[model samples]
Target: MFWEALGSAVLGLALAWAAVRRLPHRLPARAMVLPTGAAGALFGAFLTHSALGSAGLPVILVGALAVSAASLSLLLRPAEGLRRRSATA
Candidate 1:
């Protein structure tokens, strides 16, 4: 269990770091993104483990990645100079 958690966290941090590098303009500060990704992965692992207590580590890791990516995506913003078109069209 410990190894599974550690792996998930590492994966999540790596994913966040990659996002921070690739989408610097869309994502928020590193300070926020880093932790959000980690926490999200932890939460995902917990949830997945609870739901499938005997599931394999790979499954849990997949869950962690999916949730982490989703959480990170929440922090994204529209590209520069793009205004809201749906609200005032």
Candidate 2:
């Protein structure tokens, strides 16, 4: 459990770092994406752990693959710029 928690934390940090790097230049560091990515990763880890409790390695592997594929699909979707703030004087 200790190692799993440690690994999850590290993974979360890594994802957060990646997100921060990909943010647009106009965005402020204080409002950057690291926190969002980190939170998502931690939540995903917790959910995955809960769902796979006492499961065998093969089942765990399949579940991970499914989750990862879904996440990748969502991430790769084209951004509609829905979150962009319009310029206002």
Candidate 1 clash figure, as a count:
0
Q: Where does candidate 2 have its weakest 10-residue lDDT segment?
A: 68-77
Question: Which prediction has the highest lDDT against the true structure?
Answer: 1
Tell me, what's the RMSD of every candidate?
Answer: 1.7, 6.9
Which residue segments of model 1 deviate by more than 4 Å?
Answer: 81-89
Candidate 2 global TM-score = 0.48
Model 1 whole-model lDDT (C-alpha atoms): 0.92
Model 2 over residues 1-89: C-alpha lDDT tens digits? 45444555555556556544664443346243444444455555556678877554444434443443344334433455656666982
Candidate 2 local Cα displacement, residue 75, angstroms: 12
Model 2 segments beyond 4 Å from truth? 26-32, 54-89
Model 1 per-residue lDDT tens digits across residues 1-89:
99878988998899999999999999989999999999989988988999999699999999999999999999999997886579757
Residue pairs with clashing backbones, model 1: none
lDDT of each: 0.92, 0.49
Give per-candidate clash totals: 0, 0
